[model samples]
Target: MDTEAHVTERDRSSDPDTREGEGSRSARFLDAPWRRPALLGTACAAFLLLFSTFVMQPFLIPSGSMEPTLRVGDRVLVNKLAYRFDSVPQRGDVVVFDGTGSFVREEPAGNPVTGLVRWAAAAVGLAEPAETDYIKRVVGVGGDRVVCCDKRGRVEVNGRAVDETYLYPGDVPSRVPFDIVVPQGTLWVMGDHRSHSRDSRDHLGEPGGGMVPVGKVVGRADWIGWPVGRWSSLERPDAFGRVTAPGPVGSHG
Candidate 1:
């Protein structure tokens, strides 16, 4: 990924002067932000664009992959700085990531015009995420042993069972059985609505072993921001509080 490209794009969108690369609109926008032509809507869009670029970004839920916790069309507030200052992602945190290599081999090439259109709309939570973007809950983080269904049909991490109260009703922890140690700097993530989500479980046989690298994470989802009535905090469940991270080979015994 071109890190500088994303940074440059954010700079251009946030600063009207640097927006010259965007075409003639920069000239008109700089003069009177809301005066002639496009009116108030243009100014509002610019403010939202700036906010989304630097602060919390609104992400529209594209499917029922997260279900009861996050419904379709629910706009989520992604805290961009949550993991920026040497903060590591923990188990039970919801995160959005670029799933190119781990979730899918690579992002398919698309026309620049169409891709631009999608990016513009998706920026403000009006459209689905880009082809490689995905959101899921972190089940196991770097070096933890993750297993499915220990007698009670609950997922276990580092030998502790996880009580997933957020899971969609009637769904089991996992229908398929597997036991694997999450690699360092990667996450074993899954969706709340597991049956409907194609997360780490589905990619168990693929390269990277379905672990999403911490570097690929965009940010942690802290709240749901839209639909007026459906707003709420996406809390980190406490079920993992007693669980422990993996220790060196001989340390545990």
Candidate 2:
């Protein structure tokens, strides 16, 4: 009788339903209220990271290079898809590009943690731009003759004057004299604050002659997204009005 009683107890404990009930209770504990929010927060963070890295990213103004148009500390939205569909950047468009082999001294560096934080900040439109990133106006597109001080000290593109009224007050179109015809699939960019900026003109003696390859261009700056009082849509300057469309590679004034 004792043996039979012991066996009956053991069988009851070994039942599949009994085991399943304990598993269900364990699962409920593991999925407590806090777990949901934690998981959700993680998912949200990952989505934002992906979006900022691969899609549109917000960049903050860190220097006076693009001043008057983009002030220090102002945030701007960089449209990554703008160039993905289109093959070239247009005149008067503000562009951001990787300065790896083109302009900046060196490629930017960041560890995993720092990168994550920066990405989060940029996603929220608060972080400053990366060190190796550059923002400038496209003065000459592929196959355009961009010469400085065209008799009246104005930059000329395809034999037409570019009215740079948006340039910083007291800033000339270019203080450094340069005369170069942009090659096909390349761009010549300059800053509005010509005196304060180190643009393509700065690297005229360097490799590639300060010209940014079309492949390196990131996107156009379409709007200023932060600092509500300074918010405004970026308009294409009407300065290129009389400029002719790009013709043969070497044909220009």
* Model 1 lDDT per residue over 1-253, tens place: 7656443335456777656666576666667744654667788888988888677788999889898889998999998899987998999999999999999898999999999888878888888889799999999999898899889999988888989999999999999898988888999999999899999999999999899999999899999999989878989999899898777754433
Top candidate when judged by lDDT against the true structure: 1
User: lDDT (0-100) at residue 149 of candidate 1?
Assistant: 80
lDDT of 2 at 3: 50
Reference-based lDDT, residue 27, model 2: 94
Estimate the TM-score for candidate 1: 0.82
Clashing pairs in 1: none
Per-model clash counts, in order, read 0, 0
Off by over 4 Å in 2: 1-31, 108-116, 246-253
lDDT tens digits by residue: candidate 2, 1-253 = 4656444346656889998999899899888989889989999978877776777777888889888999998888788788776556889899999787889666767698998677577666777666777899999987788888788899988778788998999999988888888888888999889999999999999998899988887778888988889788888888887898766765652
Tell me each candidate's TM-score: 0.82, 0.85
